[model samples]
Target: MTINLTMALVLAVLYAVGFYLLMQRSLMRILLGIVILGHGSNLLLQTAGGPPARAPMLTSARPEEMADPLPQAMALTAIVITFALTTFLLALAYRSWTLLGHDEVRDDVEDRRIQRLERRLAESEEDAAEELEKEATQ
Candidate 1:
């Protein structure tokens, strides 16, 4: 895999900023973060395939010198997928703004309730495990 220092640095920055934005509460910022993260991953996939070269046509170049097309194809697919996701996010943001007059996402009550239940379940499991261990020892 050929990795240019500049490209790697750029990718790193993109990922860092993307994650930072993703952690924020704003819908538009989250969408931007997802797009940035997608772009960074796409760059990573492209860089993993090594330096660019002529197309992998048999007659046009030697077998050893031909560039692999797999990475580019993968990057293209990711691009399309990311573009679709971005569009979806955009639509969601627009709809949310129209309905609520703002696009900030508040915590879901059901999500919090589920989290509380999960916490209790985990605690009960731990207690049960402890009881089983104590029984085995006694």
Candidate 2:
């Protein structure tokens, strides 16, 4: 198999692992999964463009021996974007942990239940306010 194809297969495996980790409730695992997915995407992009022969600089080189320069450029862009996103995710995770006193995300079922209860409470409060308004009007 070609180098690009091998790299693509590896990237796919990495993405699967990342997806699995992301499904976990732990904030750290989620962050790590995101980073892994980012790296996998970057690798896929690089592999798609094929391997680079030499730098894109204007140097005295044979035309036939040179590889595609686009992949290198794409890799650089992906690296920068990945770095920024990773940093932002880490910061957000840290802030969430500090504020919530726990890194693990609450279970989806529990969260939905709490949300429903909160909505009911809010509706009751609103009804009471409306009744008070009506009494005042009367």
Candidate 3:
């Protein structure tokens, strides 16, 4: 289905902001991002169904005039999924606050170690290449 320019722009903005928020370290910001993304998704699904028409259950209208029920059902499913995930994130944020007194996410020690190892390996490779170049020059 075709969407108006305004609606398309709004969807783009919602997705962009949502992704930006998701990249933040704050748990609350991430939760908000998820909600915004969910909204964008629902809007996209609804747009795919074309314009709204008479209810599918009502037989008073022709089949072509009846609204497609799939999009509505999918939107409802998305809402429930979003709600469940939001609740889960809220609980995690609450638990994190109780333990750390802050909602910021921290890097894990294992990840740091892996980064250091990768850095060292890259440095070593660079050094080896430089040594080979020097030998060739000599």
Question: Per-residue lDDT tens digits of candidate 1, residues 10-93?
Answer: 999999999999999889999999999999989898888788788899999998899889889999999999999999999999
lDDT of 2 by residue, 1-138 (tens): 166566767987999999999899888898888889888877877777665565544575676557677766787888888788789878878988899987877768988999999999999999999999999999
Ranking by TM-score: 3, 1, 2
TM-score of 2: 0.64
lDDT score of residue 126 within candidate 2: 100
Cα lDDT listed for each candidate: 0.93, 0.81, 0.95
By TM-score, who's the top model here?
A: 3
Per-residue lDDT of candidate 3, residues 10-108 (tens digit)? 999999999999999999999999999999999988888889799886658888899999999999999999999999999999999999999999999
Preferred candidate (lDDT higher): 2 or 3: 3
Instruction: Give the least accurate 10-residue stretch of model 1, judged by summed lDDT.
Output: 1-10
Q: Candidate 1's error at 137, in angstroms?
A: 14
